[model samples]
Target: MNYDTVRSVDPAVADALEAEVDRQGDTLAMIASENHVSEAVLEAQSSVLTNKYAEGYPGSRYYGGCEHADTVEQLAIDRAKELWGAEYVNVQPHSGSQANMAVYTAMLEPGDKILSLDLTHGGHLSHGHPKNFAGQVYEVENYEVDEESGRIDFDEVRAHAEEFDPDMIVSGFSAYPREVQWEEFQAIADDVDAYHLSDIAHITGLVAAGVHESPVGVADFVTGSTHKTIRAGRGGIVMADEEYGDAIDSAIIPGTQGGPLMHNIAGKAVGFQEALQPHFEEYAEQTLKNAQALADHLQDHGFSLVSGGTDNHLVLVDLRDSHPNVTGKEAEEALEDVGIVLNANTVPGETRSPFVASGIRAGTPALTTRGFDEDACETVGHCIAEVIDNPDDEDVKAEVAEIVTGLCEEFPLYDDDTEGLVFE
Candidate 1:
């Protein structure tokens, strides 16, 4: 983990890398989209395979010296297939967004219509946000969560799908805390004759472990981030029936990306192997339990959670009723200062801009990876509520910082070796 050679050659780069390691070690990462990969996965991601330019799929690369590349890539593909039960898997998209792009480019033409959830209501930008390439290339419409329930309004979605008659309907989310009804989404897509691309980017691990429902056999295409809840290093993946395999492979290769991130694929292989262990199921279950603890404790503290609760690993706290004056950014900053790091997120019916949203999103994947149990998570929830409620209070922050420090020490991330390197 020490960047010794880099430090000898470029101390400046080494210093920043060391600082990042320190940052992750010292602070709690509560971002719903983030997780801590195993040391083996980290080592794989930093492997020498990064030097290779296997500009095509395994055993069929445009370049020579793809033997090792073929071995690692096939392992990733096979492991992914075993994990998700997809007839075909593409481990070359580089990111979840790119995975979505591969599906879109492969299945639909330019100016094709897309129906997706609103970004403020938990949908991802890659689904159809105006700032993203999907929005620029596709005619997009959005469905929303029920204003009162904070769950997807299936009737409303069906109505919009019928009206828009989209070519595809994106069925995954970014900050949503509920277990999505992929079958229901497939029904709507089927009714409207639209393809369903279920982007289980956040719940990749949960879905893989069967803690969450599988979309692989239900949706027309399933896409996800290899990181996040999966802890498979950082990359993207696409899964589909064998029918669309060739198109997706083509889309990924000459379409959305050049060569795959082979090193990250190796990491994915290692992480997927780790996930295949019986313990990963326990870890996935614990992740959800910890999230429920956070949600329950926050609600107990008088905070309002969108959806009222959670079925997955994140809780979206809408501050509108509990602390109308406090913005999500303020809450995020306050929590970060106290060493509890999460993110500002848009709640349903948000009146504020995305930058200063009305809600905060926190998740348990990283904490659970650090071995946080429900009790520890409940304590984290208390610290978060205290800080969010009393952002300007040094006394509150100091008090919360102690709790965070204690938790970090009790569930230390990384080892005592190179990770003990100083930040500043």
Candidate 2:
């Protein structure tokens, strides 16, 4: 974790970098979209491969001196294929949003219609928020989860699809707490004669480990970020059958991005290799178990949970019912003050501004990576309930902070003597 070379060259930036590492080591990361990658992944990302400008796929590049780039990129591609069982894979998109952009470029026109979940109802901005490029270029329609059940109503989605007649139907989600039935979305897309793009950005590792149902063979296109649950490099990937390989590759390179970040791809290769090991599945399963435990503890404590529980790594708490006066932002600040890091998020039927939403979303992937188990996650849930229940209590915040510090000490993340970050 030491940055001696960086310190020698630029002491100020080095200080910030070192401080960031220490911050991660000290706090509890409960953000559903964030994870702690292994030190091996860290080293690979900072390698000299960053100097290259590989503009195309492996063994078929648009530039010279790309042999090592080809090797690293191919290894990433191969491991991703093995992980997801896709016939084609593209590891070059800069982020999950860019991956979606490439999918749109490959399969859609500027004025095409896109039907996706509503952003406030657990969908992502890239799915077609009014301010995002996808919404500006595409005619977008949105579907909401059932109000009472907090789950998708397939009948309503079908009716919406019939009326909207979208050119593409996008599935998967960001703040969603339950497992997705990809085949149902595929059936709706089939009924509408539309293409299906399943964005599994948040559950890439769970899907790869077979803990969650995958959309790889079932959807028209599958895209994900490597940094989320997969904990690879900070980038996106697109997967499809070989029939759409050339179009996807060209769309990602010329239509969306310029050159590939070869160093990041090297990191992806190393992380993918790590994920292929047997213990990664144990980590993935533990992630789900931890989420369940957290969800149960929160619900038992009288908090309102979206979906009533979780089938994955996160639980979205709608504070409107349990704590009427407390906004998500207030709870977020109080929790951060106690060294527990999570995010305020929008829930279904949101009435407040997105910035001060009525809900909080928390996940267990990062804590699970730090070797947290079900009991630890339940304790974290208790800490959350405590702070949210008493957002203005300085005494409670101090007590919770002490407990968080003890947990961080108990489950240390990166050890200098160990071989990178390891999970038993």
For each candidate in turn, give its C-alpha RMSD to the true structure in angstroms: 2.7, 0.9
Q: Can you give the lDDT of residue 8 in candidate 1?
A: 98
Predicted model with the maximum TM-score: 2
Global CA lDDT of candidate 2, please? 0.94
Q: On residues 206-299, what C-alpha lDDT tens digit does candidate 2 reach at each position?
A: 9999999999999999999999899899999999999999999889888899999999999899889999999999999999999999999999
- Backbone clashes for every candidate come to 0, 0
The C-alpha lDDT values of all candidates are 0.92, 0.94
Q: Encode model 1's per-residue lDDT on 18-54: one tens digit a residue.
A: 8988789889999999998887888899999999999
